[model samples]
Target: MDYMTLKEASEKWGISSRQVNYYCVEGRIPGAVKIAGVWLIPKDAEKPIDGRRKNIL
Candidate 1:
């Protein structure tokens, strides 16, 4: 499996690196592993769904 750094994932996902780190820490991204204090995310891993709540009338 191909793995990418947090920065790469962030850029590919069009999100902030900090947000990617948060998602990894929160277990939102499957197959994401931290090694030697660095995050390795699978290149094929889909971006996690947003958790924001929406108001529907």
Candidate 2:
């Protein structure tokens, strides 16, 4: 399984690392596991449902 760090996931998702952290905290994004002290995002994790709805902005 491919995994991405918080930074990589953030950049790929067009969001901030802080926002990814928040999503992790809120349990929005599944397949996010904490390895060591950092959050690793699974490459196969579900994408955002729609492009129109976003908490950002």
* Backbone clashes, each candidate: 0, 0
State, as a TM-score between 0 and 1, how close model 1 is to the true structure.
Answer: 0.88
Cα RMSDs, all models:
2.0, 4.3
The regions of model 2 sitting more than 4 angstroms off are 49-57
Residue-wise C-alpha lDDT for candidate 1, range 4-53, written one tens digit per residue? 99999999999999999999999999999999999999999999876885
Q: Write the per-residue lDDT of candidate 2 for residues 1-57, one digit (tens) a residue.
A: 789888998888887889888787777888888878899889877655544577786
- Report the Cα lDDT for candidate 1: 0.94
How many angstroms is residue 57 displaced in model 1 relative to the true structure, after the best TM-score fit? 11
lDDT of 1 at 50: 68
**Pairs of colliding residues, candidate 2:** none
Error of 2 at 28 (Å): 1.0
Maximum-lDDT candidate: 1
